[model samples]
Target: MADSDGEFHADDASDDLEDHRVTTSSKHDTRSRSRPEKAKKGTRKSGKAAWEDIQRSWDAVVEDADGSLTAAIEGRAEAEKRARLLRDTTPLQRGIIRHLVLVVDMSFAMLEKDMLPSRYELTIAYASQFVREYFEQNPISQLAVVGMRDGVAIRISDMSGNPAEHLEKLQGWVKQEPQGNPSLQNALEMCRGALFHTPSHGTREVVIIYGALMSSDPGDIHETITSLVHDRIRVSIVGLAAQVAICDELCTKTNGGDTSSYTIAIDEDHFRSLLLEVTTPPVTRTQEQSNASLLMMGFPSRTLAAGDSIHYCSCHNRPTKEGYKCTRCKSRVCRLPAECPGCGLTLILSTHLARSYHHLFPLRNWVDVPWAEAKRSKACYSCLTAFPEVPRTESGKGKTPEKGKGKNNSGSVPTPLKGLSESGRYACEVCRNHFCIDCDLFAHEVLHNCPGCQSDTRGAQRQNGKATSNGDANGAMEIDS
Candidate 1:
């Protein structure tokens, strides 16, 4: 009986040992899996912190203009708190205002000796002085001139921050023989175009220095007046011996301001005051002048807030239908097998077409100050390099490069990046944006602000030697605005 009991105990001990081995093997497997998981968790935690830090650093710098300029990033929200403060606190003079000047009535009648020095000469002098004064007070407002004569309206120049340069172009335009028929319709149409093309921040106005000559296309004039009424553009007419019916009809129908028998002889102070009142907040216009009930509609005005998505479409009265729209000239085009149906431009269907194409290049996300100086210097957008090689015009005069001269030029075929089968693939560290190496190297060194950093790109190049100067304009570094 004792021998049988000892055998049973030995069997129990062996079963216990077997159970312990299974438990140890399970723990080993769990630990092996858990070790890798813990390591991965640590890595992710660090990465999250890094991303947060990057964002925080950017925000801090953006608050102040000195450090960096990432806040003007395309597709980013407006820094409203900052801008509001600027509007309120900045000690702007009462006369410090921007103006969009449009000269109307470029017809042959304007060449007649109706006003001092012939209406055309007086027009140029007074218009130029008004522009110079407005710019001297507020140099930041963009200026564009539209010459209306005959039956056609042509843009003398695009909206440019440097009105002086555009003024020079206007002078050149004046020297040319006047073409087209005398039509206020053309002038009004140009105003509509200017309103669409001009930046949303500035004030806009149309100054018609004419003898009120009626166009053969009177029907077109009525249609244009109706359109202007709806579009809410302030039309100021300076009549120099013009027909009473023409001036009265325009002033009454359009609800505009008409200076009858006036040839820049109105009280300067009163005129300035009138201009100031019109430019005041909730800017208004009226047929008959009064302190109350001034209707809105003025030039170079800030109707649209900053960062508002401006839809530039040739098709009037239609909301911007999405899909493919021409970036250049802002014309709407529907997709066909080939060709832009609206503008007849050859359509290259791709996401990068707008960015790569020079003419359709996106608007500047940030406001560049001292525009006259900037244009005079021909400051590069990347390096801010001014006075580079002078452009060879057909007339052999020095000129700056037109927008979009880099790789993937509007005229040239796009090439693939290194080992990549597409254009616009490289990245810049200083600019903190992607750009082709060719663009970076070309714009190295100058006062130009980076679209990414919004700071001088030269500093970025010096800090990081890894930054290649292949095509960057500022130290071969450019911020993609």
Candidate 2:
């Protein structure tokens, strides 16, 4: 092409060199010789600049397994894509950024039936709306997600500015069942790998939506969270109906951040407000300071994951003198009643109760509760009892049931079940022995620790006969005759 704007030339390649010299002459010009000498020097500078441009472009096209591109590529591609996309859309000015947030939580604790459709469903619905609205306002802002399912880390969707694509990916990811168990540490690590490592420009964040459910080792996430905060990466947290105590600790230790917890809401407006508040774009420095102060002032009194009983009593309506605690449950109950509100047992009249409901519930009353009622309670399906309750005192105080009168405390002797008197053929999953339903589940959960998800190979041995051609030992097979 000819020199359209007189910035270049069709045949005057030397003129391009002249342009470079003019732009740089004041900074690097030295004693000049003849025209020919100057032209040769200009050519060398031109070749060096051209080489740099090629190297920069090449670095952009390659990326790693987790979808992070090199800085050279990541920076250029992001800029180029933004420019191209903006050509058809509105540009973001100051205070113009819209937040595209994706909150994910599939922790097992979320499966509790007390909440209709479950906590996991509520989280997904609100978070999905947040993603939708951000795209509606500023389509170019990036969205990302990570969560846990069955203890395995799940990357819901890679960070991307395309809302339609990101939403589609998240929907697909959510359809699959939770993997093993919930692990918040695994989810946060996945978020770190997805967000900060890449050459993402502008600001980035990873909001954690969770409750008292968490992993065994949250301290392990300290380095990643610290780095993100120091970098000025926002980590807004939504505490849901409940949240992990460590979440507040992590947020405070790094950024002195605030969290929001939504009590079960009966109205749509409340749900909308909770969603909007958590997903709002980052506030100014002064507002953030105010938020930090608010977080300090309104500290949550109930401990996160302090076991169900303490959590329940701490939030109960009747407030007692702060120190009047129950002796038997050690659950900080008022002195008005001799019975512990947690376990519904008579108080022992000691400074500290000898038993904690968690231990007593699992060890003594777990199987003792009728299966019908236990099914309605939020007990572990495998163990059929609520997990142990923890005490609030820092001194490691917890009580256990009395020795002689633990579960089924009545002094009267009881008879064993009448059904077990008759001999019945029931193969045990492990030992392959014939047993009733009562013993089968006990052996499966307690003795075998097997989840009963797979086949029981020992069924053949339980038959006590050779297999028939049709695989039915009851007929056409050699019985012991």
Candidate 3:
């Protein structure tokens, strides 16, 4: 291929390169051609499946990063929604007696490392908080925990009002490892069976902490949903991973086809928020329960077993040094806020009724006060907390018609807005008074009453002054105790 004078030729080198390229192409062709038809089809299908999984992961990570104030505004809106959910003061019949089933997904998917220390570990931690809050708010209610794993549902704990027992069972999971797939149908069926004995006057509900995207269901899930609906059972789902259509459909159908019954946790804090939201007792379905019914409950007296004496408990049949004695049946029980097994009578303290009382009459949500009006006030009306002053802008100094009163539009609905919070103050709709964030949250979430509206003294002071002038005596007024 080279010239006789030992000169290199470009044409000869080009021919060799083309031959090598053709050889490489043929090798690849033969390799692919050697595969059987079934193997080739499987490869194509698996490639698509893998691609779909990647797409889902991509979707999970891809969040809206629009470089605008939209995200902040939306975050405020979420806060507003929470306030509205917590602050409604309307009087309604609530479920005083309740039974809630917790359905947990224990599939191997929970072992994923996306969440710190693994999703399963964090889930148990969040569930511990949920159980604590559930019993704190629903002292008279019973709760059962059911776990779905290995294509079946297993009862982890029985229905009881004791938070300690549930917490102990959750602690028992440290030695166990998650395995297999979750069975949604089986979990629901087990919940339905366990809650079958729930009284008609009580609320029957299920809260699922689902982790896997797929459910290993053998039966028609719609049929199971139909049965749940017929039994007046409400279902709420807290999805730990990507959203699944079956879970959406299952929660919606069980809760009378309501869409709010299911929510996905974007992070750890959001997961805790969603889980605790279920702790508040759900409204009783009118057709299922009557609010006027008088249910009898026994106030058990706590007694201590003397030295060398063990009292037999009706609850666990175990001997304990101290137990509550049911006044009705004269039987010793292990715990209060429990039903007496001897006479089937509820044993609870009257103070426990206050746990659910605030729900019946929640405080109205406070609205944000805009900078103009908020600038007029130097301190909170309730707590007298100093409000940080906004640096007076040349524009703010200019006289402008105060149009932000529109922020105080209504007490019934919450509006996610920022113009109302230039000074970071919340205003009660009824009293039109500004309050700090801490006081606002405390009043709405805990106190459930507006201190200004409940204990205003200016009008009383004026009345006392007028009465003193007429009486021609000391300006002192006596308050009736």
Provide the TM-score for each candidate, comma-separated: 0.35, 0.36, 0.69
Top model number, lDDT: 3
Instruction: Please list all clashing residue pairs in model 3, or write none if there are none.
Output: 369-420
lDDT of 3 by residue, 1-481 (tens): 6789989999989999999999999998998899855544424555554344544422322123343445355546545644544445567778867899998888999999777788888888888989988887778899999998899998999998988999999889855789999999999999999899888888999999998889899999889999998888899999988889988887878776589889999988788889998977777656648547777777766799888898789898997999888887788888888888989988887667655677777777777776667666788988898875543434555653343222222211122343335556778887788888778766766676788786654444345346323222244342221
Instruction: Give the better candidate number (2 or 3) by TM-score.
Output: 3
- Higher-TM-score candidate of 1 and 2: 2
Q: Which candidate number would show the highest TM-score if scored against the true structure?
A: 3
| TM-score (C-alpha) between model 2 and the true structure | 0.36
Q: Which is superior by lDDT, 1 or 3?
A: 3
Model 3 regions lying over 4 Å from their true place: 1-91, 301-312, 317-323, 370-384, 389-420, 430-434, 452-481
lDDT, candidates in the order shown: 0.44, 0.44, 0.77
Taking the candidates one at a time, how many backbone clashes does each contain? 38, 15, 1
lDDT of 1 at 139: 39
lDDT of 1 at 298: 12
lDDT of 1 by residue, 274-377 (tens): 33322222233332221323212111111232364554334333444343454333445322112333554433322222112221221222222221223233
